[model samples]
Target: MKKMSTDNKLISLLRQSYGTSNPQEAATFLSSAIGRVLKMEKEARRAHITEALKGVDLRRDAGGGMNSKPKTVYKDTKATQEKLAKLEATLQEMKAKYHALLNDGPQTAEENTRLKNRIAELQKSIENQKSQHFQELALLRQHSSNVANASELAALQQQLEDFQELSTQLSDECEQHKTRLKTLEATLEDKTAQVARLKKVMAEVAAGDEANETNVHQLELELANAQEALAVARKQNEEYNDKLLATLDSHLAANHEIDELNAKLVAALDFGQVFADEADHWKNAHDQKYADYEELQRRAEQTQTEVQSKYVDEHQRYKAASRKIDSIIEEKDGLHRQITHVRSLLKFEEQKSSDLTRQLSAARLEMTSMTDDLAQEKRVSELYAKNIRELHDQLALLKNRPVLPDWLFSGSMASGICFGLLFSFSADVAPAQRVLLGVCSGAVAFTVARIITKKNHQ
Candidate 1:
């Protein structure tokens, strides 16, 4: 409860220090504060690890102390490693998928747009072909209706039938060709993309393999060094143990001497023979031996902790290398699948290309046949347009003339209106009055010209 209250107080204090009061502002403040705190925490953890490592050296120098239970430590380390491996595998898989997506996403989108445009063009071409086919069928029908002889009519009908059959067959083939081309193009594109992706992935796999090799070499070196250190520590501890045994023997011998002194005193000849100062010296030596034993025990414990820490550090490094290798292997497997898919697409594209070439040849032949027909039609259309223009001119010359001249009928109203404006300006009249006078004069002049033209027509 106290911890929670203290955390809340800290948050409030941080928010104030960052000059934030609103909830959103506070959130930003909290984020930065937490980030800084995490950085500090990480630094603190690193410091602790270093300190623990240093303590190990200290313990080794002091001599072998009792180690923590090896079996229990091993079990814990194994479990931690297992969890780390699983987590790293998951993380690596996610990274591979994300990288693949980033690489291919834009390319896939661009290919889709290109395919859409091709489809639209295909649709437009098909529509135009359909309209042209209908027009040609109408023309053939008209020609058939005009046939006079039964034999000729039968021949024409047969020809029309053949042409229709050919056209229908050609159209069907064209449609099929288009459909096949679309399928082939799509497959080809798919294969090409897959091949490219696989190639890239394989390269990455190679690079990853090199990285794994390096990591493995590093781990091996570290392991060998650790083994050597352990051996040296063991030898030191053994020597220290031997020295402790020798100290025990000396302490025992001193006690034995004190016992002899006591026995002599008890026998009642030895007030002169017994030494009180020598007894005091033996007691102090026993005390000193016990203190040394305790110190040795403490040093042994520190050395054990140091060895455990070293093992953990090496284990972490090994786990990281294992994770990288696992990721590389997974990518290689994915690349194999992509390569197979690409090969299949390549075959489809080859077949599609062959079909497309045949279709192109047929289109070129049809275009050649249509060329003369279009030119002949254009010439006939031009002849009809020229004749229509001559007929129009003839009719225009044969028509009756107008009663008045072009300028008299067309220009009189314009001239009178313009002169009336000039007269109004010379008289210097008010704007409204001048406008009225100008309109009246122009109206009078137009009425007189119209009367004269009507009389001339009569």
Candidate 2:
């Protein structure tokens, strides 16, 4: 009965807080509010943990372990803290912007849900990174101390291992950043697509009403400003990427330096070993000087023969190399000559091409002249055809008339008589003979006219 009373009181409190008469709605609001409070508490705890991590310095112990000391490792926790702070600030800014977006206008339920999921994932990733960083710091602290009696080589080995591990961790972090960058790019693309969709919808809406045109235009300007802001953000992300790459490069260079140091140390160790071996050899030789005399003499003779053989071999090799060099020089000269010949050929081909081009131009001009001449001939042919048609019409009219005209006969007779009289006077002929000649000439003229007219008709 007491539990029931307490539940009733809690329900009454939830109803009053939500100002809802419906019990179900009140319960839902209370549940969601409690969830939000729990989430805020988690975030606070994470913040506290990160703050605690900031004070932990991962420094290597500098105690002596050998004659040559290993390089000291100093990793500043402040840089990590700064990065975390920046991330948190960015997250907060995103949350603020998201809240502003929610207040500005209605959004799709799917979009809100997706954004919530993404925020949750980001929080989870940050938590995982924090845990991983804590583990790495613990590992560093664990290995910071060196054994006092350890050899220099052993210390160097340990240092090399530590550097390798650190490089691996850096590589992992770089990969994580790359993945995060890709995710951001994908999110940016989605946002740009969403903006485009919104613009399209606004345009459709604006088309429906002239009264809202001004509002639509204002919205367009706001969208444009948003796009500009997005571009600025993208540019900043690119700058951050460049900075990360530079850091990776620096780490790689440090690793390279470490490798060089290791090589030098190895070389020094080898040289010391060789010096010790040589010293031991000389010391033994001094203790057995007389006993080694014959052995030394035989060894000297053997060395002299070997030297002579080596000298002969070297001379032969020198001769062979000299011959090879001579052959190579001759080959090089031949190649040079070939190259010069090819160049001359290329020049000749170029000249030939120019000549061909000029010929083509001339051919084109000749073709144009030929076409003009053809057109003139066509005009002249047309004129000739017209003249022939006129002549045919005249011939047809002539065929319809008599072969000789009555007027023509009289005119001819008179002209003949006059010509005959002139001939008679000149030759002192009689009037009778002149008249006869005139008559005959007139008759012959009439006959000739008749025949010519008949042929024209035919």
Candidate 3:
């Protein structure tokens, strides 16, 4: 069940890290990630070798210390030996704790402090070990005139081997930790850059929103101004309408007065005609009435001229009123057109405001999507880091295991003995020929063993 869960987790990580839904593609991505880690490990190993070579070269060049092989054979007395063992045990415990902390993933501040303290203790232990080795070397050099006992040499050799083994383990662990730290630091830098970019984009978006808001406010102010202008235009129109109505009422009154005057003029013309006929009759009957008839005809001619002049003046006044009404109507039409144009402008501004609002919403959505993408990338980076750590753990396990099996060694020896017997055991074979045959047999056996080992490793 745990293995299945681990596989499923790895599969999920592959999909998320590489953005691949296909199993094959995800596998490919997993292979690539593993390959990258292997490449990094190879590079790190190469760098370590180069640094070690450089250190050796430096030590060789600095000859005094290199020449003085510290040979002060510090007798591994029981008490000193026990202290060494205790220190070694302490270092082992510290190392185990450190590895446990690393495997536990992220740690709290207190845990981090403990981890640092553990690391310091480990360093101090290593330094102590180094100093003790140096002291032993010095003692051995100082006592070089005397031949050392075999048992003492063997014990010193064993101690040196133990120290080398511990150093190798610590070095490997340190390299793995350094690689992980580098990976995490790189990830952190990338996340920081992304956050900065996002912040800059958000700032730009805010500026755009502010500008859009300002435009909207200005448009609203213009719309209010237009509305006020429209209201004023309407008020003026109403006043013009009232004035026009009043002018029409006065024109109607004038027309009524003109009609009454026309009736009076018609009555006067009839009366004059009757009077003219009476004058003619009187002139025919009596000559004394002729002078009075002449006077009455002159008065009638003057009254006709005055009435014609009054009619002409009234006709001119009516034409002027008609022109004024036409001008007023034209002005009213112009006002209506102005109102329509203002309405169109208002609608356009409203549409613009709505468009800006939609743009703002889209920008917000884009920002949200960007944030999600950054979060996903951060998660993928963390998973990749975890995978690297796991790979390192696996590599460490592989390194600890023996490359060549014990069974292979035994089998190779048995096969070599058998091959020698087959080649040199014939009754008729010469001694010299048997020696040659045995050598050939042994060479063949060794070659076969090598081939088998290589194939098994592959």
TM-score of each candidate? 0.31, 0.23, 0.28
Question: What C-alpha lDDT values do all the predictions have?
Answer: 0.56, 0.53, 0.53
Q: Candidate 2: lDDT over CA atoms?
A: 0.53
Q: For candidate 3, write residues 101-218 as lDDT tens digits.
A: 4465444678646744664465456446645665676456445512333344445455555555555555555555555555555555555555555555556655655665565565
CA displacement after TM-score superposition, residue 260 of candidate 1 (Å) = 4.3
Judge candidate 2 at residue 40 and give its lDDT.
Answer: 44
TM-score of 3: 0.28
Q: CA shift at 53, candidate 1, in angstroms?
A: 99
Candidate 2 lDDT tens digits, 19-105 = 543445545656744553354457754653344335344342344422233333236599898999999999999899767644654
* Alpha-carbon runs more than 4 Å astray in model 1: 1-156, 249-458
Ranking by TM-score: 1, 3, 2
Taking the tens digit of each residue's C-alpha lDDT, what string does model 1 give over 117-232? 66446534644564466467645644453342344445545555555555556556656666665665666566566656656665666676567667656666765666666666
| Superposition error at 154 for model 2 (Å) | 99
Select the stronger candidate by TM-score from 1 and 2: 1
